[model samples]
Target: MDCETGFCKNDVQCGGAGGRPPASLAEFTLGGYGDQDYYDVSLVDGYNRQVTIEPIEGTFRSTGGKYDCKKAGECHSNLLLSCPEPLRHLNSQGHTVGCNSACTKFNTDQYCCRGDYKTPETCKSSTWPVNYPKYFKDNCPTSYSYAYDDEKSTFFCRGSNGRISPDYRVTFC
Candidate 1:
């Protein structure tokens, strides 16, 4: 019934008496960057699988970074924030498609808008529909917002008008 840091116990034998050694544990060390911190984690498994997790943190350094908004709608006017690199072509559902090259630059008036585009019309017609969720459209609508919740290991989004919305979820990649 014993387990390590990132692993749980699995009993393959009868009565869970004599099983394998407790699974290897993973530990993390973090380094600070401005107001952000990056992490390095050591992972071990019973199969001798050892892995390292690094570069686990991110933040906007640009003074005019529009993506740094505290709420979704607030990100609309800043030209510095655009679709995340992996999310450009994808829609709110996270499906991938080719997006407009001009989309590389932030456009509050465009289909992808700041956080999420308003109507499904704004989303479905652009790359957002294929890759993102409908909630993104409903919540974000105009601008993009960002917030960090350390307890949940999560980042939340909001709209230009400072309305909180569900945008993207971040996990180990």
Candidate 2:
């Protein structure tokens, strides 16, 4: 797999190091708080490609009927094709390689959700001068488009008897 981002210089594995920004990410925390497996497909760093995470088997619940332990991220849409011009990441060949987040492209407090926009209450993507996250969310509904997309983006699965966590299948394109 030759990744446009996360390409480990001539190596197959990253060896614990993280990939660069402008790449789709499958984030996971196994045996997290409350013995649950938390997972999400994040585009907060930007989107180089589409990615998905599917839970194999587990005791799933929607707590308050809010979240579900289902598939996350995009399996179809190609964000690069629809990337905004200002947020488009170009390669040496002048081709669009990735779709960068407004925060990554502009580096503003409002877009980055930092400074005064640090809190969830203040960091509403809808309030931005240009809602860039909306582009990602509208295309890939299950992905984490920005920093505070937790209510819709975060997903978790628990064991049947607190003994087995669900295995996940992460696919990238």
Candidate 3:
């Protein structure tokens, strides 16, 4: 018996006594998503054949502020979605990851309201997840201040003396 994409061949006697269909070709057919570039598949048969497909690149146009972690360490956009669990840990391991201070308005009525200052420090300490290091706790323990310096193209935690600390020089992106 032999099988191809759309058909199969089986050898059987035509007369005397009817021969059974080849067991190999009994349950085989063109079964998969016809339009998808790749199929979600499982082979129940004993044969160990290998297959590979080239990736298809799509050109969907998007309209929004681009996520430029390279320059800002973090970006604020509604377009961002929750990171997957495993990657969330990795992204937030050293410092607060995917933190968006610009979009979240901190006011007296807000749930995160603790004081007058509307800073990432307040938001991060109170609202950000506890597993990862907060901005002040990990990167700027002594300074407790951070800024996205466009000139330097980096997010820097500043010390109390208004100087970028050696500890805060590490890249969060």
Candidate 4:
């Protein structure tokens, strides 16, 4: 994406437009508040394919990196290998493959972050079926693996184009 008035400084030092950092489609500058952007990548639903997001440039602290449904760069997301046995999805070939969340896999209010577990504390990653949340989190630190995921799953980039609001990108690798 192109910004007409500002710059997006990617925290990781990827090459941004005209020497500024950017998100999936915009650029920014760092000195102003109105020019800031925030973003997140989520897998709270499940994993089916691959995806990669790398910051290309900027002066902000965003320093983007790569993550896929299967792996972060060459490091495996480990969904298929470490996902809870009950939450595993298989292909027609009957091989263990993708994985779903406890909420989707079991439809439980506790795991789905509904009912009594509406708060972040009630629906924590450890309260579910095994360490399933960690299964995804350990694989993709930049993405959400469960209902209560915060801070660690969010990212920010400086926006200098004098624009507000944010953008998101979901690509399959």
Q: Which candidate is the best by TM-score?
A: 2
lDDT of each: 0.26, 0.84, 0.22, 0.52
Better of 1 and 4 by TM-score: 4
List candidate 2 stretches off by more than 4 Å: 1-3, 8-17, 58-66
Give the poorly placed runs of model 4, Cα more than 4 Å off.
Answer: 1-35, 58-75, 161-171
Q: What does candidate 4's lDDT look like per residue over 49-146, in tens digits?
A: 44443333332333344221121222255556765677667657776655676666777888789999899878877756566778777776666677
What does the lDDT read for residue 141 in candidate 4? 66
- As a whole number from 0 to 100, the lDDT of residue 154 in candidate 1 is 18
RMSD of 2: 2.6
In candidate 3, how many Å is residue 148 off? Answer: 12
What lDDT score goes with residue 33 in model 1?
36
Q: Write model 3 residue lDDT over 37-151, tens digit each, in one string.
A: 1111111111112111111112111122231111122223211133223222112235313222211212132223345434544544344343222321233222111121112
Distance (Å) between predicted and true CA of 37, model 3?
Answer: 48
TM-score, candidate number 3:
0.15
Q: Which of the predicted structures, 3 or 4, would earn the higher TM-score when compared with the native?
A: 4
Q: Flag regions of model 1 displaced more than 4 Å.
A: 1-7, 10-24, 28-34, 43-47, 56-173
User: How far off is residue 86 in model 1, in Å?
Assistant: 46
Q: Residue-wise lDDT of candidate 1 within 1-173, one digit each (tens)?
A: 53322222454343733223212112222223333322211111111122222221233222333323222221122111333353334335664322122223233334334344554344343354343322222333321111111121212222223322222222221
